[model samples]
Target: MAIIFEEKQNIFHLQANDTSYVMQIIRDGYLSHLYWGRKINQYNHSNKLQFVDRAFSGNPYPSIDRTFSLDTLPQEYPGYGNTDYRNPAYQLQLDNGTTVTDLRYKSHVIYKGKPALEGLPAVYAEDKNEAETLEITLEDQIADISVLLTYTVYEQRNVITRTAKIINTGSASVDLKRALSVNIDFRDADFDFLHLPGAWGRERHIERQPLRSGIQSVESRRGASSHQHNPFVALLRKGTNEDNGEVFGLNLVYSGNFLAQAEVDQFNNTRVSLGINPFDFNWKLNPGESFQCPEAVMVYSHEGLGGMSRTFHDLYRTRLCRGTFRDKERPILINNWEATYFDFNADKIEQIAKAGKELGIELFVLDDGWFGKRDDDTSSLGDWFVDKGKLPSGLEDLVNRVRNMDMEFGLWFEPEMISVNSDLYRKHPDWCLHVPNRTRSESRNQLVLDFSRKDVCDEMIKMVSDILASCPITYVKWDMNRHMTEIGSAILPPDQQRETAHRYMLGLYRVMDEITAAFPHVLFESCSGGGGRFDPGILYYMPQTWTSDNTDAISRLKIQYGTSLVYPISSMGSHVSDIPNHQVHRYTSLDIRGDAAMSGNLGYELDLSKLTEKEKEVVKKQVSTYKEIRKLIQFGDFYRLISPFENNEAAWAFINKDKDEAIVFYFRLLSEANSPFESFKVKGLDPLKSYKVENTNDIYGGDELEFVGLSVPTELNGDFQSHVWRLKALK
Candidate 1:
């Protein structure tokens, strides 16, 4: 690993191997160094900022010098750079507000902060395999003011990445309320903010406010008071009703024992501020105590919120790129929960395997109700033994039977939870995360396992690994059915209670890291009650995630459209369930449902044995079509030609990487009141290039498609209908 510091360009590049993984880093126009492969704390208090001038001019500041001064600085100057700035050992202040001292200073101008701070540039490298990390530190003290910033940069692949841990090591915490604003060119008429619930499943919105100055704060708390305290705030600036582009700003304020706050200003000026808030805020940090806040990420792009989302996603992908599909075969899987529920034996699984083989399914997954005394959701959890009543021959025999049918066996495990009625909870009630003697709540008849405890995490990893090693299971569907309650950890020390959530997540990553290392070929899918845990963080370990429980074709159009804005289609699990649609209770045409499901990793969630003959035939043909074009749909670049939100009719197109073929799906939600023809002009194609169109029923080409876009004759008087066209570029 090498750290490349282009001093003249104000850019720091860290390269691990030979990849340009971490792209670029801008340090407010100051000399920045590239540190390589070093622990974070080594550079703590090393980087210092000199008070160069007052009356700063730039969006943040004209120069780093203008922002810090020694003489008469705020008495409570909160530390910057690192989150744990309240420690007196790291604090410094100017006597006469003139000069201070550097606690972790290495040189004159170079400052070191966390590796993540350099943004993308500091960690830029050529190849991820050989990439190294660089630790850079800087510090300056004149009079009473002292400032420090440290960063680390490294390369994992052909990508550059950087992470910064900013620490304001000063006697008086300074109000570092700063904003780094970037001007973005959005060429779209409307946009939306995508919100993913942490534990709550309710949908909230920040409507498009078409005016230049207003602040809206929405509070969301699903019965957790501490969670309800701080409301997420959004500020929108719209140019004009007719104007397409609008400037939006979001601010997340951190209060309580920690005094850090960040505000993003993008209306007249673009800037982001990270530091302590100055308004009526005074918190005492005991001698060795510390405070840390969540990271603040900003995105600016010309393609609206969807484009901005892609930027962040692309950044994550570049940093964490583990190839998917260990082998090159479509996973033909059957999840047994819907098939047999809690009633199944070795012979029962054998029967299902025989049926699946006849239907071309390649994997048999045993969902919940397999472990402990678990006949239902209420009983055993944490007890990872086979339920003798259900599977008398044990999991090994069941797995062998499925494998003998030339199919892979898979199993489901909610490792992060435990049923209160289980033996594990009965023996070690303190192991669960709850305030001592407080009421313990249960979701899905289970309590969350305290992953923050090393012993609990170890136990889970050991039991899960043992099961996989003992059986021929090739896949694992890891599910988390509920969000956290009680929010307290028994393992963490009293002072570190706030750190439990982060520690639990870290523990999860550790277990996964070990699992994937041992079983490289086994596939893992992360599910949080469905789509609750669908985020870039979870995607780091799993290739795909269950999209949502709502599989109604009509509702899914919007649900999936919103989902695709952030995730790739390959990562979405779209299953064809029985109509009178299970969740939404809306009946959709079988053809429409199959077509909608085809837009994702096509599969069935309904019981195949219960389907009518006609329905089964529809599924058989649907499966055939999916097998034929799954590759094109899976790996193709997607484009939203017409938004389902803007128009009643939803239209989307998928183009293969070669650009030789494309598929456009247009669904007419309802007929327009008086329009002669309910057709919309489709975009995202080369107008001059002639192409042949193939609908399942008919094929049309060249001149026949020249004037009018693909038309659908009124059916049921044009209430709700759909049309799909496969377009191939004519050679």
Candidate 2:
């Protein structure tokens, strides 16, 4: 069993394969965090919770002991206003208008397997032996509320998932002011705060800072988990690097507004909290009503950030993400967004599809401007019907033409948005999210649809379902171009107006659940103006996401590398787009672009017919080479040898599950004159094996390549140069 409970000491120990998390119900019923790190064979009842009577740290339970104060104790889930002044895991406003809450440990249950969250995305236990769960109930008798804190430990993974369920057990209604998923108190603040933060085109750029004496956080108030900040944060020990030292990471499995923060108190104790953002948010829990927070995943790695990343990749790729495509090799698709954009006819699209087919592309995706009377981003967003002006005959005809070339067909849809000029918006102006009489702000020339309404969600499901059922669509590129603005639902009550954003996410998940389930054969790839909503919640429904809109090879080195910190390679929709790149407008070689793109699900987003014969031949070989290693690239274990953020040269490797075949990609942004000989140690290779490099006479023992180093090709020249080395274990 992964979980063990000691009744005498009131301690709960969650032991994963390589890590352990220990906590206990201490004096006054407060659950104190004992330890979290490398697996401890036996905790030996180590009590790290110390009591210090500081000047202002109030002692809530002075009758038992005057020095016992929550402010100084390491806590699991803490509440504010009652001695502990730190950020709370949850807070409730009672009927009497008091905001203080005192929760005492009631009881706990240990069981096999994990239970799914009521209406949220979470990691699951596929088999009973895969995980164990513990539920600790804490009750606030005065408020008549109970918070059920659940912890699930994956038996073979160094991961622990946490969630909280707040139930209003009294007859009176309770207003939940804040409900965070999980919280942990560290003994010291000596760590570096690592987060993925960036804007639209440049998503998930890793940034790390040393912990100071205040709050360091990454939050999204933009409704969708905006491109500004991902729902993940990590803490690295002082001297930790990519390969060694301790790292603790947390990720929220939610797509809506969320908060992940680390607060270093004046006493130097660090409190980490993650869950739904309490900003502009409130939930009214009536008697017998319960509110469930989204799940927060915790990864403890003594092997540093790389070790932390691999654990998340393994757990999320196999457990958190669901559907048929989760384990399957994604097809090499060619999207026409960059190729034609809002200017394309059926004949033009067919030409591009034919050109791609001749070069070994397996799927052809027709991007925007195919629905409603849409000519540009300004109109007909909610209209899901095909535009006869663009298709001439309808979606079915175009789909048939693509399928005729022995290629799959994919279509793009932005179902959660509406244009003021759209027919649907004309019929129902209140359909878009807005505050009464407030100017409905527009982004990308569109407004976010009020998905909080069942009417809106039903219409979206119907419209999207009709299109999929009408055509032989094999894939879908679901896109949302705008974030929420004036985010008030016309149908919700005034008191519940603050619930608009979260409700919208719930409504979207419901719609996606229904539509994707109905069209089980369709391979769905979620996009929020490209990588805006690329989070675990969306990945639960759609297995993959468009990594970014900026397909520039050099720019993508950082984007892709940072993304690999939490997401699996199979979940990144990377493509070789036209250069001068559409977003950055910086020209890079075709070879480097392909090299950058091949690290994920390979695709192309350019007008293939416009390529020269030489470029076409190069693209054909890129496609063929990608096909030969698609499975290895998508399913293999990923290793980040060198960070693009740290060096001008970036390198990464992928080794198959059998540890026999390996592929390494090295890229340089700019050629350095007389650069010193470059070699870097690789990882995850069997030391006993001798491997031969493909297309060369070079052979070396795996130990030499992994320990001594793998050399960069000295002959390569010019800026944005790249090389791919394929190694095969020799008998």
**lDDT tens digits, residue span 180-284, model 1:** 111112222233322322222211112343322222223222211111122222222333111123223222211111111222223221111222222222223
Candidate 1: deviation at residue 95, Å?
A: 19
TM-score to true structure, per model: 0.71, 0.99
Candidate 2: what lDDT? 0.92
In model 1, which regions exceed 4 Å deviation? Answer: 1-162, 166-300, 303-330, 346-353, 670-676, 686-688, 695-709, 713-720
| lDDT digits (tens) for residues 1-731 of candidate 2 | 78888888888989998999999998768889998889988898565566666867888766756687788888888998988988888999999999999888999999888999866788888897789999999998988999999999988999999999999999999899899999999999989999999998999999999999989888999998989999999999999998899999999999999999999997999999999999999999999999999999999999988899889888878997788888989999999988888999999999999999999999999999998999988899988888999888888999999999999999998899899999999999999899998898888889999999999999999999999999799899999887888989999999899989989988999999999899888999999988999899999999999999989999999999999999999999999999899898899999999999999999999999999999999999999999999999998999999999989889999999888999999998898899998999888889999899999999999899878998887998889999999999997
**Alpha-carbon lDDT, every model:** 0.52, 0.92
Give the CA lDDT, 0 to 100, for residue 628 in model 2.
96
Error of 2 at 271 (Å): 0.3
